[model samples]
Target: MTAITVSRAAQIRFSPGQWLTAGLIVAFLGLFLIVPTGTVIYTAFVERGTGTLTLVNFADFFRSELFVRSFWNSVYVSAMSVVWGTVFALPLAVLTTRFDFRGAMVVQTLGFIPLIMPPFVGAVAMQLLFGRNGTVNLLLNDMFGFRIPFMDGLNGVIFVQSLHYFPFILINLSASLRNIDQSMEEAAQNLGSSGFRLMRRIVLPLAMPGYLAGASLVFVKVFDDLATPLLLNVKDMLAPQAYLRITSIGIADPMGYVISVILIVVSITAMWLSAVAMRNKDYSTVQRGGGGMARRKLTTGQSIVAYGIVGLILLLVLSPHIGLFLLSIATVWSFSPLPDGFTFAHYGRVLEDSSVYIKNTLIYASLAGLIDVIIGSAIAYLVLRTKLVGRQWLDWAATAALAVPGVVLGIGYLRTFYGVTLPDGTPLATLWFMVVLALAIRRLPYALRSCYAALQQISPSLEEAAENLGATKVRTVRRIVLPLMIGGILAGFVTSFATAAVELSATLMLIQSNADAPIAYGLYVFMQSAAGRGPGAALGIIAVILVALCTFASHYVLERSRRLVEQSHGTRH
Candidate 1:
């Protein structure tokens, strides 16, 4: 009897669905994470002649000044970006969320523009404006008889990255600030608390979670970025270091793997800290009753300052795409204030050769979007809705991808799947499936978070009611849960699609020699070739338009679907 009871208890603990979910999670980690990581480690350590593990890779990396300098350089750049991002983002968030001025809506929208633009595009744009022959440089030289040195190395990379990522901090902090109960601030103000003291004691502590979350994201992103550094010739960083080990040096060099491991460790630590910060606080300001938006009137001077700030931000964010658009349409690009002449030749050439790039990007992005929504929804359900063992670990693992740099993951994929062959004896060395998989995995964290946020808003009693009526778990999920969660799934899909479209570093390593490249990669190639900058600019312009169209379409579809659901529910009632 005792033995039977123990056996039953164990069986209950490891139920079928739980086991199945666990298996799937493990399989995903194995294929995408473990196998690739293990491969890198294995290749890094294995002795060529004796086929025995060694530690030469670590030794070599530690001894190399280039590697050490790049590692510290990466840390310095990322830290600086975070500091600047926070300094600018905090005030903007507080002002926009706490006190409203004229054109507040416009300010909020403009602040988020950088979120959609690719980091590489931002880097390129900065180069065009601040480079030796750039507009700013030309102006400075004409006025002061000297040019500014802002486009060569660390300074350029940090500036562009910070500009591109500050929006993340702004949006996050804004949301956090908006979530603070008005009564808390009201009570403080009533007690004669004013100015910085009120913010220091009440507002900052309340909004710390959002600030930390945003900072963590920026740190991980800047750390993992490869394009900004690469474009600016700052290859002493981990991203470029890892890339060089694979392409410039041979895969036989273990230094890349060592950097990969270190990146993973640092990213995981950042993520862990962010998770700890977010655990006790709720950052959801879009709830049912959040006071219907806090509205505070701004003074005349404040309104002018707010509008000026918005205009400046818009100019900064839009300048790159504007320059790219002009270059794309110009017949000749010289050191003039504008293009030499406008023509449709570049667009025509792009259209003629657009099929391959367009098809590849659509296919890969679509597949990644679908896969992310499904996997993300399931993980969200498992963690937020179900009572599962080791749920927190699963949640953390799902999001851990956010902290990983695309370049590092790309290297891991190369190492893990390099020599392995598929079932029909076809070598997997040139398969672009790994590239798609990497994109999917890399973008999974955001998708999962979006879905989790949506799922948490739903009442558990709804699912319980369905189950009480004898509905099977699967049926209830399909009929009851999915309908409610479709909005989240679609949102995740849009976000994932956008990220995959612009992803560069991971694609750089995983893309096959013969396979079609996405627009970002294609632009990189075109810009580097002998054909000057016309073609690359044209392609960038097209890519930007496509992204805008897709996002607008997604918004329309989601809004229409939501309205239809509401109408149908009203009819039923």
Candidate 2:
């Protein structure tokens, strides 16, 4: 009878549970992500009026000097940003990881703080500090008798992007350095390699994979960014041009679709090349156990120089935050080293009039974050636990969202869902629910990564043990797996929520009214008016605080979970 049951089960293509889970994932990704992205690509190749395939869009893009320049401008900015960002990052990573310093943890923690704020949120404040008539230039004028255009046009785009994204390089390089087997370093040293020679010969090439990963990310991000260029008033770049062509010329414009396709292609290509370049290159080492690259304690002079360099970089990186905080309360802050006066009326007005933004952001970002972790948890389970065919493809498809620019996705969503309405008679695009959906789709990759990493850490025996105790798979997952994964799920939620709260491009396209705008849109609106700069700065501060609080909460949950895990292990042992 049992053999007959097994034979019948073998005949079935999938169990009921597997079918349900896979079906849900396919539907969710299909309805929100795959369909929209497909619509954009399809529209790009066809004529708007005739709906016939044509090469005119590609031809026109290359023929027009304006479009061609914008394309190259994106490439130039992304390339330069990666160069400058690596220059900032490599030394910082080396300093913190290769030497024992008292402030290493602080420096490491503070380095990543720049990523927590959206780029355009700091644009106005950066203009106040780095623009021709701004604070640094005024000081430079007083000292050197000349002003430099640090924040001028394309130059400013590279500067801001490099400063913000260098942390990616730093974090990746630091991890790669720590993970390196120490035997290679000692072998190189025994061969008369020392100082720069050691790093040049042994370390750099081995860490090349990490560097490539970070550099490709920097290029993709800067290439697709629309807000920084718009805030800096550099509209000749591809992303800004895409925005202008769509918003100004309307969504029917073929040039806009052409720009979107190009952006998506370039982004995916950069990431793919990075992955391919490192494949089969084997950087493994024979070092045993916990041995990593050796750390050397810095001499007093070296320590001082390291700290000084760190201090200088931190000052430059934090300028936007300090300037924004001051500007939020300043009555007037123009053409001077600092503000002339300050007040709290901006905050008061924000709380009084624009508070809906804060509330909606809380609702929209929270729901998006919750939805992302649920999806992430399911995907991670299917990929890691099951023998299901094409399960890893679920992970690949979700992570592919990283290569998709938010602006392109925004255009995709608009084109795909323009006329769709809910049962309540409200257009789907106009609902706050759409904002939540869009934010989830954009940030799904982040949450999925976190959940996948967490799931990988758990032993499959835990589930087997649960099953041995007469527990069903659903019961075991609900009672055992979810609890073990709470820390990572919490982390995924915070990252998704914090980043979504600051999403500009998708939010700008889908948001139906002022009543529905989030804090990011509020900041954008206030920054546009000269008189509204104070309120804008105030809104920017709130955003920074929101992100900081989310970060803190994530850390707290993770720490507590770690302690609990350690306790359980101790009890078991």
Which one is best on lDDT? Answer: 2
Q: Which ten residues in a row have the lowest lDDT in candidate 1?
A: 284-293
Error of 2 at 130 (Å): 1.0
lDDT digits (tens) for residues 1-573 of candidate 1: 999998777645645776588669767866896677666656667765677888876788789899889889988988899897776676567777778655556676767767666777666667777777888888888889998877778888887787778888888788877777776677788999967898898788878887887888888888888877877778889888888877888766667778887787778787788888678675444344355335577789887887676566667656666777777788765575666799878887877775577678888888988888888888888877656677677778777677667877788777667778888875575587777898898888878887888788788898999999999888888998888888888889888998888888998887765346887777766666437467777777777777777777778878987898789979999
lDDT values for all models: 0.77, 0.88
lDDT of model 1, residue 181: 74
Poorly placed runs, candidate 1 (over 4 Å): 1-18, 41-56, 273-294, 422-425, 468-470, 530-532
* lDDT by residue for model 2 (478-537), tens: 999999999889999999999999999888877778999999888888888889989989
lDDT of 1: 0.77
C-alpha displacement of 366 in model 1, angstroms? 0.5
Q: Indicate which candidate wins on TM-score.
A: 2
